[model samples]
Target: MKKSPIETVLGILVILVAVSFVHYAATKIDVRPQDGYTVSAVFLKSGGLESGADVRISGIKVGSVTGLKLTDDYAADITMTIRDNVKLPKDTTASVASDGLMGGKFLLLEPGRAKEKLNDGDKITKTKDFKSLEDMIGDVIFLATDSGDK
Candidate 1:
């Protein structure tokens, strides 16, 4: 059976749309750091922290930010999903850090020496946020002018 030219064009258009939809869905999915337990941390200030931000250890990405919310006390709570193979110590620290002078934000994890390990839903008690560039510059200026030799 011979198909009409209009039918052929419609079929091609349908296939193109399907392919485009698949590509869009795949790009939106976050498929890194395979399924693992989640840990929570509280920060005085998240400082532009958002879901999908990279979680790193010593500058190496080990996980990603899974969620963010505010606690009853007004502190920001961030949930991170880390790889199953990476077992964080009980005393580990989580801090919000920036990539560089011009880069996005991420979580920095520093493991501490502890016999115990953190379980799912465990909260990291220690955290540090990135300092504003203005604040940093002001501190440097103050130190430079406050020297006794000045």
Candidate 2:
């Protein structure tokens, strides 16, 4: 087929526009972790928590899970990289929580009201294990059956 000059120019323009759009989207949606400081927390279990999971405070993302390790005490040691701007207290608590019933897992950071601030590489001594939906449901059922029997 014979193509005119206008057709060729329009095709080239479309290709250029597509490339520009991809570049723009890539830059805007980059999920690479930014410069941050690291802190460690130990949980009884990872509970499906993986590296790159969100580490949030008050439902807002302030950091991310950078690594996971098993400690000699049989606990899940999680390494979190938090933004340098966010300072946490020494007594802060870290808990593994789900987004909802049967939703994804994330680290929930509950900052403590204390005079001491946590330093980089410091360990978070307090942590709550993740409670699964089945556990809660079983407890509810057990309570209901026991009450009915009584």
Candidate 3:
């Protein structure tokens, strides 16, 4: 059988749309790894944190989580690449935080007041592990019940 002109035009239109999408993805949404300095932080819990997750400081993405591993001591050791321009202090705090109530997790960095700066591959000793929603709810419930009992 032979295809109609309408079918041929429809097929061409679909191909054009696919090409446009590919071009947009390649140019606008960069999937390539960014070049930056690498630092690590160890957490007691990952809470579903993954590689390629955003590393944010003051709600802005300053870097990305490049690697995640379970250390021998059973901690979540996360290696991240931060922008060279964003220098972190030696006492910077790193935490596993969720974007929102039901959003993905990211590595949140809180730069400290130290005059010295963190060097390449330096481990952030001050870290907070991920706290899930359930944990927070349980804490609140415990406090509420304990207050009533008193």
Candidate 4:
């Protein structure tokens, strides 16, 4: 027996919807890179930090931010997954920096000279937030006037 045309179209629609759902689920899941370890940092201000933001070392992409949260002390907590082979020293600093005047934000890692290496769950102590252009201009103007008075 041959199936009706309407029934055949309905079956196709159902299959298409199922496939679309699977695709959506796959994309929503966070698939971390294989050779990486997760680390976190607390910042006073994240300043446009979002999940999937690039984490860089010496202007080179090393990892991406995976998560962000607010701590009890009212600070922003950012979680990043860095490659395992890229060992960071104990005194390393993690700061929030921007790419350029109109570019996106990223995490900058500055390695220190400490002998010990950072382990998982270690928090980077030194952090710098994005400074607004207006603030910088204001500071420059203030400095110029103040220096002239002196």
lDDT of each: 0.89, 0.91, 0.92, 0.86
lDDT (10s digit) by residue, model 3, range 40-86: 99999889999999999999999999999989998888999999999
Tell me how many clashing residue pairs each candidate has.
0, 0, 0, 0
Best by TM-score: 3
Q: TM-score winner between 3 and 4, please give it.
A: 3
lDDT of 2 at 81: 93
Candidate 4 or 1, higher TM-score: 1
Worst 10 residues of 3 by lDDT: 141-150
lDDT, candidate 3, equals 0.92
**lDDT-sorted candidate list, best first:** 3, 2, 1, 4
Off by over 4 Å in 2: 2-28, 148-150
RMSD of each: 5.1, 3.2, 1.9, 5.9
Better of 2 and 4 by TM-score: 2
Model 1, 38-104: lDDT tens digits are 9999987788888999899998878889999999999899999998999999999888888787889
Using lDDT as the measure, name the better of candidate 2 and candidate 3.
3
Worst 10 residues of 1 by lDDT: 28-37
lDDT of 4 by residue, 15-127 (tens): 99999999999997646563588888899878878989988999987788989999999899999988888988888888888878899989999999999988887888777
Model 2 C-alpha lDDT per residue in residues 1-150, reported as the tens digit of each score: 899999999999999999999999999774875678899999887789999899999998999999999999988999999999999999999999998876889999999998898888999998999888888899999888885644
TM-score of 1: 0.74
